[model samples]
Target chain A: MAKQILSPLPGTFYRRPAPDQPVYKNEGDSVAVGDVIGLVEVMKSFNEVKSTEAGKIVKFHAENEDAVMAGQPLADLE
Target chain B: MPIKRLLIANRGEIAVRIIRAARELGIHTIQAHSTADVDSLAVKLADEAIAIGPPQAAKSYLNIPAIIDAAKKTQADAVHPGYGFLAENAEFADACAVAGLVFVGPSANAIRMMGDKVAAREAAMRAGVPTVPGSDGRVDDLETARRVIAETGFPIMIKAAAGGGGRGIRIAANPEEFDRLVPQAKAEALAAFGDGGLYLEKVIERARHIEVQILGDGHRAIHCFERECSLQRRRQKVWEEAPSISLPEAVRRKLCASAVALAEAVHYSGAGTLEYLYDDASGDFYFIEMNTRIQVEHPVTEFITGVDLVREMLKIAGGEKLRLKQSDIFMRGHAIEVRINAEDPAQNFMPAPGTVTELRVPGGNGVRFDTLLYQGYTIPPFYDSLLGKLIVWDEDRPAAIARLIRALHELQIGGVKTTRSLHLALAADPAVASAQFHTRWLEGWLESNATKLAAE
Candidate 1:
């Protein structure tokens, strides 16, 4: 079964920690629980979005710098 | 040419502020907004509204080309970059001129000059203003470093020339610490910014953040007086008061005059603020930097001076020479302003962005609530957390504080956590009441009163 990674915060989502940095996790990258998948910037404060269940990233639902809502699916895991 | 139509390239409370000022001046207002702010108060109040781009500020408010296109499409004769997004951007100022539209602030040259720390310091020195004594450029040699240290004395800061934002710096209280930290600071600077260069500056103790508000029309300039914004969190001022209570009458005259001198030297146009750090014990004030846009705390000065600063900016941009002289401006009484941000004081001021379910705005004589909040309005999560500024004025500082307290109590907003309670606690604080706080005072106060603030 496949699972979706939902953002717990409503804000702009960034795949990379910073503009100059690489994406935290690319498609096909293996993820573990507590691994920081991305960052959500809400009102100028950055909050790390970490995965809860360990799995492999199948695809990213949101692009870099996409405005997201609470519980919005950011990535899919299998 | 007088401005007939104006385009506001900003959002939130400031956009509303610009619209109000333009409306009073009989100028048609075209508010440029993001997709998230379509239903904002500013949009509804504006004579016209246009969408620039997406919700993110970079794609919207900060998008220069998009904003320029909007102005052109709307046939706006002037552009107002209300503080924050492209407010102090020299390129944006130049871009507006290139597009044959007037920018409602200083020239691009003035913004460029004051934007650089080194150039601004030099400008202050040339205008005979006292600046914080520091090493004249990089202290690359041991002899120069020793001489600079001797001049600056004990309790000095060894800062990296290329470093900023409170990084790559170390404070040495004495000679022993200086000796131990110099090499370490050099190594850190080199590792962080690829530069081993360093400088030294005198660490002013008990420094209070004082700034003079000045207006100009490219020739003459006048000051509205100084504002004290020492109460800060993470270098962001949360509360502000005009006519600094700490400055003696003589010191106040000198501080405000120096700012006017600097403004006139540059032939500055529109409203600008020159920031300074004052040490009351020594009765010494030093120029720090200049903000070339109307600041968030501007309302405090407005209350004390009875001047419409935004209106003045519009008039100046419309090719009018300054209508008022230095003698025409006078400080009436004490005024205070507290920022009401969409933040939960209980959660360490964590930003809370949601719909404003219910709203009860405070109203009375000498109390003003400049906000974008309307019933059922949702504050977007993409921008800063500042929802409004609650300003109050009275006969004196104590009276003003009392009014602030009363106003804070009467104010109410629901469905989103606000910083009103924290401001209430600050109003009641003994140090704040007596105006005995400094720039570093609020962070400590927040830590000590965290439980109490949360419980409230």
Candidate 2:
């Protein structure tokens, strides 16, 4: 079974903490219940996105720096 | 650079407005829209349309790189950022410069200078324009603020230097409140603006909100008189009228001249508005801030001055000097604009985002509706709730009010709730009709009369 990690806010989603940094988690990488998977930038403020369910990363549903709405899927976890 | 094909970097009524103005200038328009506005009226009316990103504004409207790419991709030589969103964003203007695109507005330095409230006040003061007395710069300590307060007196407003859209303001009426509010205001400013810059201003009691419209080509600017926007709800202007019926002729001239002086001092170009707080008792006005882009209430100014502000901005961007001198400008008649929002006034102004099942817009010789709505159009939930603006122009204030009332009654929108009924009631209200309302009067009136108004 796979579960999706939903974005908590409507903003631009970032895959890494900074543009120069590496990806926070690659596909097939293991994740914990409270892992920081991404960040959502709104009004020039960045908020860390934490995974609620522990599982291996399946795929990212949204592109890095893509505008996402609240409750939209960011990544799928298996 | 000649602005042959202009890209409108915005959405909603303003985008629709830009497209119309661009068409009048014989310039093709490419409307950069979000995925949510694929079927918007602006998209339908534009010469071409491009989807920059998804529904979220941060990715589409506020995304600097995406907007620049769209301008480049469409071969647009210029970009016009309408009010709100990134209209006042200095970095966005700088990015357009970096991309060799003519930004249909002022320089990035001017935007940065006037965008900050503290800096704007300082500039205004240097230009011999009176601003509300307060701290000269960001206040970091309570003792320093207290000393300033001792001179300026109490009932001061602690405002975020970079704040707009009516956010980041705290009022302290006494010493205890001042002590408690300064830190909270600083923290909120830091969170919102990414800077903890705070400044104070004396609260002018029973003040009327007046703004002067100006046009410049970075060399000389001319004022198009003033508009009174005192009728507001929750700090958002609900209705606006031009050549403020409240102002004496001498005071009006001084206010407009002061605005032009400040703009000249800053070498401001394009269309901009200088907002002021008028103390009716003292018969004096204090400069508040300057909006570096075309304002939402600009139509009321247009109705009086007969100046197509958007067209002038485009011409200025294309390297044309301002043709309309101060003597060339003339005020014709009184004009009133009522903002129709997609919110139920009875239900606490609740958001009513849905499809417009039916529509009947009012029109005549003097009534005009600036909206992005049409029959069968879906009102997206992602943006501001403004549905349209009902602008009525007549020979005088009373006649304009009568026209607005008739237009409001004739206008209808089905499927979603709107502020139409509220506007109708406001138009009929004796205080509003007589031009006796202040900036805070609408909220108080809504609290007391919204239910009755809704029932009617």
| Top of the candidates by DockQ | 1
Please give the RMSD of candidate 2 to the true structure.
5.3
DockQ of 1: 0.89
CA error at residue B258 for candidate 2, angstroms: 0.6
- Candidate 1 lDDT score at position B417: 92
**For residues B1-456, what per-residue lDDT tens digits would candidate 1 score against the true structure?**
999999999999999999999999999999999999999999999999999999999899999999999999999999999998899888999999999999999999999887655567778999999988987666787688789877888888887765543457698988889889999999888876676878777888779999999999999999999999999898788999998999999999999999999999998999999999999889999987789999999999999989999999999999999999888899998999999999999998899999999999998989999999999998899999999999999999999999999999899898999999999999999999898888888998998999778723
True contacts kept of 2: 0.12
DockQ of each candidate's interface versus the true one? 0.89, 0.12
**Pairs with steric clashes in candidate 2:** none
Query: Any runs in candidate 2 off by more than 4 Å, and if so which?
Result: A1-78
Q: Estimate, for each residue in B33-66, the C-alpha lDDT of model 2 and write its tens digit.
A: 9998999999999999999998788778989999
| lDDT, residue B59, model 1 | 94
TM-score of chain A of each: 0.97, 0.95
